[model samples]
Target chain A: MSIQIEELCKRYGDKVLFEHLNLRVEKPAVLWAPSGWGKTTLLRILMGLEQPDGGRVTGVGRVGAVFQENRLCRALNAVQNVALVTPDGKGDPEAIRRDFGLLGMQGAALALPTARLSGGQKRRTALLRALWAEADTLLLDEPFTGLDPAAMQQAAALLRQRCAGRSALLATHDRAAIQALGWPVLVLAGQNGPESGGK
Target chain B: MKPVWVQRAAAVLFWLAVWQCAAMAVGQEVFLVSPVAALRALVQLLPTADFWGRVWFSSGRILLGFGLGAGCSVLLAAASAKIRWVDILLSPLMQLVKATPVASFIILALVWVRGRSLSILISFLMVLPVLYGAVRTGIQSTDPQLLEMARVFRLPRMRRLRAIWLPAVLPAFHQGCSVALGICWKSGVAAEVIGLPDGSIGDALYRAKITLSTGDLFAWTFVIICVSALFEKLFLWILDRAVKRVTGEEAAR
Candidate 1:
């Protein structure tokens, strides 16, 4: 029902990243942290890609993620890329195509390899892949990078719709995207609460 | 402003002309044969059932050896990439295979395997180290970030291979295959020459040599080149199609 991170500690050499960092998420939320402040690192740890120096994560079952990079299979089209994480990799093709269309990816964008996609299109594809994936928790790192204002708003709306009732953490520095999603913000380098206006 | 293919053809014609001039200068049938004579000899051999039988025998064995070697190398490379101890243990053996001469391997293999299988053994040995090194490097060079992404999404092993590993590994594997194809053909034919397998292209070559029929010898050499080139093209074409199927390139298009 919820994801819990307890007393997590991570560091690089002498640079302290997180000392006894703790957070919990019951619904879709924003992780607001400055660049080089280990937001990506924290998300990677949550996604089980990296091990924290200390502490254990609990209740993170069946995670889906949008990594810092788009990370779509370059040879696959947007629809096929989304289908890759689906149950038995058999997501409904029409449904994936419709979702891509909704995200303003129509015609060749849906058919062409993600390698040929623009940065925003690729970012949107990555978002859809994570949302379409079979998972209870979602970790997205800078999910709005390279998106225009309209596309960012569309993506935020999609994130809101998909992440409802699921424990999700979207790490981004985009203030506009934060306000668009209107999710509670957890500041990584400062306080770990929903107090800031994401500025 | 000639087309690239036209340019290539012109270059080939120039080389043939130079070869023809050199043959005329040598003026000894035993030492040199004109390209025209070789082509004439090839035309004569084309209608003969015996020539086709020899072609089939050598081609089948060599192709089998190449296939076996390619398959084993991929498996071994995957193993070496995944397991550090396997890499450590296999490093020396692969290096040894690479360093050893083809003649030595063919001669040594004669004592172990019959002459019929000598070409296969030599070709297999020739391909093993080259492809093993290539596919291993390809596997090792897989993008860590993509792997992490796959892990997070919990992609099944087969899906992971199709989406991530195969694409990363294919280019290097293809290059390795190209190199191995040429190597296997050279060594396979050489092994046949040494072993003198009955009714083989190598035996025909030996007979031509003993009889001092330079035209037949040149024609047989030309036949080997043509067959090897044709097989290389055909194999690479199939591999490309397989890659497209695995990566869903056709569906994407």
Candidate 2:
């Protein structure tokens, strides 16, 4: 099974983010690019959140994603946040608590609402939620933005643990994160418009 | 320094003194009764089973109306938020309810239904629009980012409602509830007064006015205020806990 993007074209008020871009994803690959290089636009297109101006995609099913922002439910605790996307619709608390622990969340931290979590902790919860959810394709967009080096490594290790041999796509500008995962990279198409601005 | 309650007590006493002075200056019970007379009347009525019956009668029907109004509004708002035609169809009706006077509805309702049910119908009409507006606004204001996340993760409808839509909708719902609670009571009581349902507080109030029993009127007014305030507090407390529990916010220990 594979996700194939064929001659995809997309634009925003004449700022073309993609044009005649054809790609095939048969294995887990890192989508490597600087900001505003249509990395997010591409991911959004893959998730079907945006429509390509021309062309079509195939074999992308049941997407699980960690958005550019942590986007955790501000009112829910870490366990509840993960449970929200669990396959059976409710995560096993003991298992999730353990998973969160390996990702560096402890007792009080796990119990606290996600709104109160530190940026790194929230980011980890978002990652764990996507990991735990049922999906044939996993998409990560700048998943390591707010983490310290130690936390970043822990996240990378956990990502590897859960995602090995799975069809996963990691999009990031973080060199260390890319190095830690050590996956093949696909640079996004540069903007085919007025000036190239890093977003 | 006095305890807070004691200070409050002193302020209440000062108001009573002013009220008594005003009543004496008026020199007629028809214009105003002293606080003491109202209290005496209240105490005299307290021992009677009829007083309790009357209290139960008005409170139950008003609450029934409130519950139905609030329930229907939330459900309809959920539908209208999704389907454009439903919103468009209901727009004029909601606007008409808001525009019409409570007395007009009460009198109009009396022509179709029994006077006893007037309070319920009026209260429902008064509460529906405010809540519908609140829920729709809340649904509209939900973060597009979170919704996109839910879509990507394939979160089920029930889970999305609980985790995403619910937390987003609650604050506005709370605001609407607060405003609607006060309004439902006022409009319900107003309807009762106009419709003069037998054995109701409104009927009793009408009798008091005709008989010039100023103390009875004052005492009943106090009862209405106390009852409505108590209900507002209770409903708000329940709503707060429900919102917290469903959304998985751990209540402060």
Candidate 3:
């Protein structure tokens, strides 16, 4: 029902990203980390995209993730992109369309190729894809990068609303989002944790 | 930088005039035939049943070969991309095929099989390398980040293939097919000309050559070009739809 990371060790050549870093997650948690400090790498490792040399991960069921980059299928429309990962292949297009509307996407934007959408809109689509997929655990890597403050707040609120009663790990340095999320922070080591100063 | 159609038309007219001039200068039908003479000969050939049989014989086998070659190359490319050893294994053989002359293959094919299968084998041989190279590059060029996303999301194999791999592979494959289609026809027809398979266009071309029927030779050349162009257009149209269907994109006309 939850994720367990046990003595995870990852290294890139001479640099050690994580050495014996361990954590247990039973609820939504914010992974507070600065830029280029292996936040994405950590998320990747959790999602089974990478292998830790010295340790093992266990108890992560089906995972849904918003990757650091908007990894949407450019050929498909926003509705199709979300629908592609839905349970039983019965994803509700109308619901997805409605979600896009709330994220400031309207008119021809929803049906247009994801490649044609603005960066912020694409980010929202990736977020919606993760949030909508049938997964017990979610790994979101900087899911709110391109949005303005108001949009970011709205997205953060939506994430909190939908992510209830699920294990979700969000990686970001945004304090306002952190405050809005109101989730316990897991401060990563080295330059991994966010550089904090302003509110 | 003129419109392609206008430039094409100008080039065609210039060639036609030169052809007419050359035929007149030669003053004999044995060495050179005018474009008008060739067209007239084509008109005569069109009404005959033998012409259609020859067309069908050559085109059918050649196209069948191309289809088989395209299919096998894609499968090989996909397999090779996933398994590095397969690529290493295929590299030397594919290079040898590419470097060897078509004439050599045709002559060597005679030793292994009957003449009728020559065009098919030749077309298959000619098409494999082109498709393999293009599809391999396409597979290699697929966005790594998206692949990571697919892996994390635990997207099903079919879904990942339709959404990610196909879209990445198709554009380059399409381009390669464009070049390969022409090569297939040329090599196929050449094999037929050498092998002289019964009831094939190459036999007809050979007969025309032996009799010194310059006009018939010219007419057959025209027919070959038309067939090649038409096949390319039709094949590419189907290919475009297939790519669009897999990518979940809007189909083009």
> Could you estimate the TM-score for every candidate?
0.95, 0.93, 0.94
* Best model per DockQ: 1
Model 1 residue B155 CA deviation (Å) reads: 0.5
Segments of candidate 3 deviating more than 4 angstroms: A189-199, B1-4, B250-253
* TM-score of predicted chain B versus true chain B for each candidate: 0.97, 0.93, 0.96
Per-residue C-alpha lDDT of model 3 across residues B4-122, encoded as one tens digit per residue = 99999999999899989999999898899988899999999999999999999999999999999999999999999999999999999999999999999999998887889999999
Which scores higher on lDDT, 1 or 3? Answer: 1
lDDT score of model 2? 0.86
Put down candidate 2 lDDT per residue, B1-253, tens digits, no spaces.
9999999999999999999999999989889999989999999888999888888999998999999999999999999999999999999999999999888888899898788999899889999999999989999989889999998888889988888898888888888988998999888888888899987888888888889999999999998988899999898888889887787654311
Select the stronger candidate by DockQ from 1 and 2: 1
Which is the winner by TM-score between candidate 2 and candidate 3?
Answer: 3
Tens digits of per-residue lDDT, candidate 1, B1-253, equal: 9999999999999999998999999998789998998889999999999999999999999989999999999999999888999999999999999999999999999999999999999999999999999999889888887898888888889999999999888888888988999999999999999999998999899889999999999999999999999999888888888989888764311
Q: Interface RMSD (Å), each candidate? A: 1.2, 1.1, 1.3
Candidate 1 global Cα RMSD: 2.1
- Arrange candidates by DockQ, descending: 1, 2, 3
Compute DockQ for each candidate against the true complex: 0.80, 0.77, 0.77
Top lDDT model: 1
lDDT of model 3, residue A24 = 79
Which candidate's TM-score is highest?
1
DockQ agreement of candidate 2 with the native complex: 0.77
